[model samples]
Target chain A: MISNRLFIRLLAFAALVAVIAAIFWSQNPAFLSGGNIRALMRHMSVQGLAALGLTFVIVVRHFDLSFPGVASMGAMTLGWLIASGAPFPAAIAGALAVGLVFGLVNGIAVARFGLPDIVTTIATGGLAVGFSYFYSNGTSISQNFFMSGILDLNDKRIIGLDMPFAILMAAAGVAAVVLHASRVGAGMYATGQNRVSARFAGIATRRLIVLAFALCGTMACLAITLLVASSGAANVTAGGQLLMPAFAAVYLGAALFGRPSVGATLAGTLMMSTMLNGFTLLAIPYYYSDAIVSTVLIAAIAIFDPRLSGLLNFRKAAA
Target chain B: MSALTADIPQRRRGADFLMRYAFFILVAVVFVAFAILRPTFVTPGNIHGMLMSASIAGLMFLGLTWLIAAGEIDVSFMSVAALANMVTAALVQDGQGWALASLGGLGAGVAFGLVNASLVAGLRLPALVITIATGALAASIAAAIGLGTSIALNNTGFVGQVLGLRVGVLPLIAVIVAGLYAVSWFVQERLTFGHYIYAMEQNRAAVVEAGVPVNRMLFMLFVLSGVVSSLAGVLLAANLSSGQPYLGTSYFLDGLTAVLLGGMALKLGKPNVLGTLAATIFLIGLLNGAALLGWTDSQRQIVRGSLLLVGVGLVVFARSRRKT
Candidate 1:
């Protein structure tokens, strides 16, 4: 279903990546080293999962701005449980439980109460972040972090792939099946495209929306759990830094595929992470990556949509 | 009269009264409650500080409320404020006068507004995401200009002193903001442009059919918000005596909360100047009281966040009830 214009845009994106990569490669030959490549892949894992979760939410025409806050909540809840000498498995369950509860709260608020997603999620996100801070007393929790062997998940390999990427791919696999191959997936797409029509056509649009948010929240926690395992610490704000990048990746994916998709989101995440890694290789200032991401997001929005033939001709085309 | 006849109208009257004045009641209750709890809260110094904050916050609210009233949004005001902060401070550091420097800052705000208007109104993209991108870009550009740090300003300029000056119990900035609101109130309550803007929100197609310049109105609202937010940025810079790239996210949260809180009162789920003024007072009082009461950061945030959720929820609830 992807058009020729999308195809050209994808090629143009590839060329842009290559050109940027070539510039970084010239500055530092180590930019293309195996170590860097592996590191970039590792970096992509959490963001990949974030984008994957977001794809489903976007497919249902809902925005979940609360994921980072939910991630923070999950990671901190796990940290709190583990610190109190709870069983490792139980702590993981507790963290996942936090995600599900918050997800459901967000879902009910938006889908059931008919609240606007933007402000409602911001409120939920604030509550999540607040709870996280209250747990850690606004500091990083690391007292029992070392004793918990969950850090092994970061180092261990599964099926010859790094543990994080393996986990990411597995989640992506499930998401792909559910979003593309299942009957519910069809309902979600239709609901997003035209909610009134979908409702008239006998789809449980509200239920599907709540489900998307619930899945999104749970998957965000799963990704953040890996981050905590990899880093051996949980803080109040680490997950927040991922929100904008996750959004950019989702937009890039939508722009590429002409619709939100799990696979395209994964690809978008990988592309963004690679460019970010390249920026790091070039020793650019840290915040510059955000500048690049923001610029790319704007460019993608302006140029990629097939509705507008050119930038300045927007009114004419829209008319 | 029978109990049923009297009680029914009384109950209905009670709700109607609440629907009209709940915001003012809330403001009065919060003010009195805080005054009773914290003796220091009612002091002139603290009151001055609160009013000063409310003034700058009021500017932010004015900008956001205009867009929101028109059924558009600008979440990037914080970023634009940061850019204006940097531009003003950087120009000052380059030995430029304050007037010129402030103009440079406001120009930055205008630039962001124009970009936002073009992307949103002209290209028909979603305002939320477009502004998010532009906000990030503005903040980053501000960071680049400041080398990812704060540039210090002395706050010695006459305008800064005037802004900081106190007229009895009132801060001068509060007077400025109130004057600006008075002007906005005129435009909103008396102007055909204002009616067109609101009509566009309620029914864009009908407005287009009527042959009003809806796109032009949208552009004007965007630019108007941009300029107002930039003004807030300059005022904030004056208060802080510095230009900072690394501003906290609280301003954005606070602005949204105040504006949305205002959505519940005066105009019944619509953004209005009077509702926002009362809401801003309540919001500023809450934060000020929280500080004086020694609440933790998390505690304050939790309360504020809940208020936002509840406020927006009430607005939705009111709308649905009206519909039914």
Candidate 2:
């Protein structure tokens, strides 16, 4: 007999397909045109990278509301460096470094200091925004990085596909390989599914938690690079607005892959990004697009075997 | 001194309460400091304006404390508030009765809450994830319904008449907000339902195992939240005399800040009503004082961030000491 899990998942995928089709049917049936498809891919890539990083931290059962903040900081640092006559590669490296340091701090606080996840991340996100604001002097950075030839990563396309998409896919591939094929992945999963059990199994639970955060931070850095490349400017609010969408993608993606895996999260990101793209193409009002996406997320999770949510209910009900 | 050390536990509880609530006190300190420094923050109009802006956010915080204390978070409360405002506006524009419109808005909010409860309690989704989804979805629906057209209540209609009536020294909206806090406090302290929620928060599984219908209780709380938020929303619409689609996002930050500042840590699983109320007022005072003092928006954000960090830091330290 087919498991309820399989049935629900199939139903979810079907719902996703239907939404995609409905969006295309309403707006531009030709949204499937090659050019539009490529553009959508690039859009998905930016969000997908951030979601991939978020998956690692979340799967370990920790919240990182600071991704957008960190990503924005990275983007601003990169853009600022590039504008200030820094070399192209150095600007990118500096951006990634900012993310790395922030991630380390987050990991240490969560692991060593035992700060609650959401509260800490929220506070850190504020700090990141503050740093970004100070760096940008409370204004949008409008100096064109593209104009200076400091960043060509966004402009370079391979086989009609944007370079950012390629870069994101490469990052996703590495995450997938490390998570699925390596022992570190197993440790991470063990820690997430059951920390006590993982500890009993001799896994260094705190180390795993820190590592997950670091990976997430690195992923966010990658996403910021793409976003800055696409927009060619950075501001304090550049990634602030992305917090909700990123949350949506992470949670909604978890509903799909049964956990936050690199592959499943990528699927969730594509589902959301393309749905938004398709809605815009079809001339669906912004409000309607929000409604449709929200419906899809809730329906996707709820319709999936009641058992999946049942476990969570048991804890909530019991507590 | 030796005797004092022996009484440390008793003394510390009082101290912890005081320190945990220092953010609220800090608000007064900030106000006084700003007044001394700039001499403008003490003006009556600026104080009233700050209180008024905070009352809108404060109304939602009172309800949210119960939900958060019960170990269920409804981030979509703000979305519900915005939707309630939008519906009220749309109704008034369409020539609907004011009373009838308010009822409809509350009903819609409760329905949204039910949806959230069903997903979180029935289907077992994490409150964080479900609330995030619902919050986004609710905002979208609100935006979709409003259709990018903000309805201003300035026209000679039922909403206009209701909104136009401001009580002397306090808007009707402000009065309604005070009423909400009173009701929320009563529900939190005087009711057995509040006790059950605290029990549920401490150990939801234990509460469920004791043969209580945890799902139903939690679901009801969410519905109650919807009602509270909707009431706030309708009042906000009347006060503002218009409904903006994205207006609810500010409430999200403000409500969360109020809850945390109020010293009700989610980890503690107990809702401190008075503490939260005090914190709400304090935050409003700080922001209002800052604005009056000619602090830039960025400077205000920095101060807000610093206050939040300090507040949470103190609470964490106090809680850890108590536990140990």
Q: Quick one: best DockQ, which candidate?
A: 1
Candidate 1 lDDT, B185-300, residue by residue in tens: 88887898777767877888999899997888788778877888887777777778888886636677777777767866766667777678777878788888988888887887
My TM-score estimates for the predictions, one after another, are: 0.94, 0.89
Off by over 4 Å in 2: A1-29, A158-161, A305-319, B1-18, B155-176, B264-270
The residue-level lDDT of candidate 2 at B57 comes to 71
DockQ of each: 0.70, 0.53
lDDT tens digits, residue span A1-319, model 2: 3568667775876687677767586666678788788888888888888888888888788888777888888878887887787877888888888887878778888887777677667767767776786676766675757566645788887776689899888898899987888888888899888999999999898988888888877778878787877777877676765666666677676777566777678778878888888888877787888788878777777755448667777889999
CAPRI grade, predicted model 2: medium
Error of 1 at A246 (Å): 1.2
